[model samples]
Target: MRLFSLLLCGALLTGCASPPPDDPGGTWINQAAIDAARESGRLREALLAYGPNLEWQIHPERQQASYSNGFELVEGRLQAVGAGQWQVTFYGDYEEQLRLQGDQLTQVASGYWPEQRFARAPTRGDEQAPLGSSFEQALYRDYLGGDWLIEEGQGQGGLVRFIDNGQVQGLPGAERFALCLAGDCAAMSGEHDSLWLQAGDQGSPWLFVHEGNRLRIFEAHNRAQFDEMPEYQPGPQRWLLKRR
Candidate 1:
């Protein structure tokens, strides 16, 4: 009878409630939703959606829309005057004008915002090409659709080059790699992986880590001291990214 009661209790518990399965993706940050929150005033909600240690931020002004973290990078301004019409201004040394639809952003003037855009700059220990689309989407679009190839040492393989229309030859060491189309090399390499760009490093100012079988973008600043100016290297004691 005691054994029967134990079985009955187990059956009742199983029928009433079951333990939940672990999240396959673990904790993830939704960059788009965070960006949307900035556009719509739900920053806290967005932050709550992501787990701890995941940093993000949104900087939208009367004439610009910018979100930090993840892979999407746009140093620009956006102005919304209702009717789904938005005026986007790209920031560099000069200002570039662009028009944004629901999902498609197009450059209105030539010579300003180039029709073709480069992918995010590659860091050390990477071999992907960096071309196609724009850095804006390269950082945001998770399922970027297309084929990418990479060249390592002297042989061509399934990697991506984001430098020139995803057509550039594989990069030699020391040259920056670009985010390409194919998922090949989408994650990390051994020591040569995407890293956070350090501040005042004279190179790029941000870093992206292709770890955990996924690409995670981080904002970093360099505080290294050298006899001469050494090139960037992945290491600890680096500035980690904060919420954008």
Candidate 2:
């Protein structure tokens, strides 16, 4: 009787240890997998969705959407709710549903209409293209996204903004400034000659360094060479910019 009881207890424990059944709608996809697919050029279709203080990049190629603020979609399902309309349900920390029609996608919870639009997936070459030097490009990718205010210096020391359209603006009184990345230079007016006129294919005159939430800007003939100079110190060149 004692041996039989022990065997029964063992069987109960084994059942308890088993994982729950997978969701029938879809399988869980992680960020690493999504990034891998994007890097390898396997992403066939993409969607960009915006909400209040949130953004989501959806890849239909993998049936996954990367959400902002760590609100990710582990698994998702698309069901036809009506003609020319489909309901997209994403399973994550909590379940979220969005309405989709053609290229437009809307979030049901927020009632944010026309929240999503189709976009092309960025290729590996697009990701690797240098905005400045390798270091500046790394910093730019990680920290340069929104508006920034230059705290100190002359002329250009006020509002320096970085836009998603690959443009930089708010330089003192100048409202618009184009960004020259690597070998590519977007057309700029002759008015910009007062500032650095000749931008090299390798780097920019305005060098950016990030420390915590603040970004520092420095002016140098060659930012890459300035970085290697023994006298170069981030503290002295005070054009500190704070994100707005």
Candidate 3:
């Protein structure tokens, strides 16, 4: 009788033993998109390629996941393969590996691009804050160092090669590219992501809006003139470019 009781107790204990639950599962956003440290390195290249508008939702049940940024959005079914190792399978048989550590989550996009980092939101509200100027500067350093296309230049799409950090770009007359303020070219881009970049001959700086995969460079004569504008939309002539 005692042996039977011991065996029953052991069986019950074994049945109750289960793996730990998903601790990082919940709404998460880009860390750099928040009030991050004044460090350009924090705005990771992989994350930037994902786009500034990033939103992720990991279900508490640990079985479903969803990712959305400015460029793409998809939902997937997730399964834990090992400790701190999980895989998400999207529609059409696409799969992505994921690694979760505490409040930070790293996702490998489509098993191609480098893994991008994300942080759990402090609250369920999921508030979004404007990005800083440094984030824009960081883009050229790593994200935009490769070749890009001038969406519509000289009546057709032209090639624009960013040799390194937009400084030595191969853009016809605008040989030297730099983002600065219109009033004072050397002034800091305070509390804003869109800064003025010179397109050379305009005798003025162009308003450069940093959008992942695409860029909108609007001609702004001066700070006072651009400030009066209410919205930012499509620009005319040699103002748009897309990643190639």
Q: Quick one: how many clashes does candidate 3 have?
A: 0
Clashes of each: 30, 0, 0
Please give the ranking of all candidate structures by TM-score, highest first, separated by commas: 3, 2, 1
Best by TM-score: 3
TM-score, one value per model: 0.24, 0.29, 0.40
User: lDDT scores for all predictions?
Assistant: 0.30, 0.35, 0.51
Clashes of 2: 0
Give lDDT tens digits, candidate 3, residues 1-244. 0000111334355533322445546566665543332233233333344433365676647599777653355788988887887888889998888888766778766545555777655433221322222233333445446667777654247777653234445565565565431223323222333333345555334455556667666654333345563333324445577778
Badly placed stretches (over 4 Å) of model 1 are 1-63, 67-94, 107-112, 116-193, 196-225, 232-244
Write candidate 2's Cα lDDT for 1-244 as tens digits: 0000111335445432322222111111122223322343221111112222123444344555443322222344555556534455655534455544433344455343433332122211122222112222222233355677777655445677654333456654333333322111111211111112122233233334455457555553322354443222222453677776
Q: Evaluated with lDDT, which candidate comes out highest?
A: 3
| Clash total of candidate 1 | 30
Q: Which residue pairs in candidate 3 have backbone atoms (N, alpha carbon, C) closer than 3 angstroms, thus clashing?
A: none
Candidate 2, which ten residues in sequence have the lowest lDDT sum?
185-194
What C-alpha lDDT, on a 0 to 100 scale, does residue 93 get in candidate 1?
Answer: 45
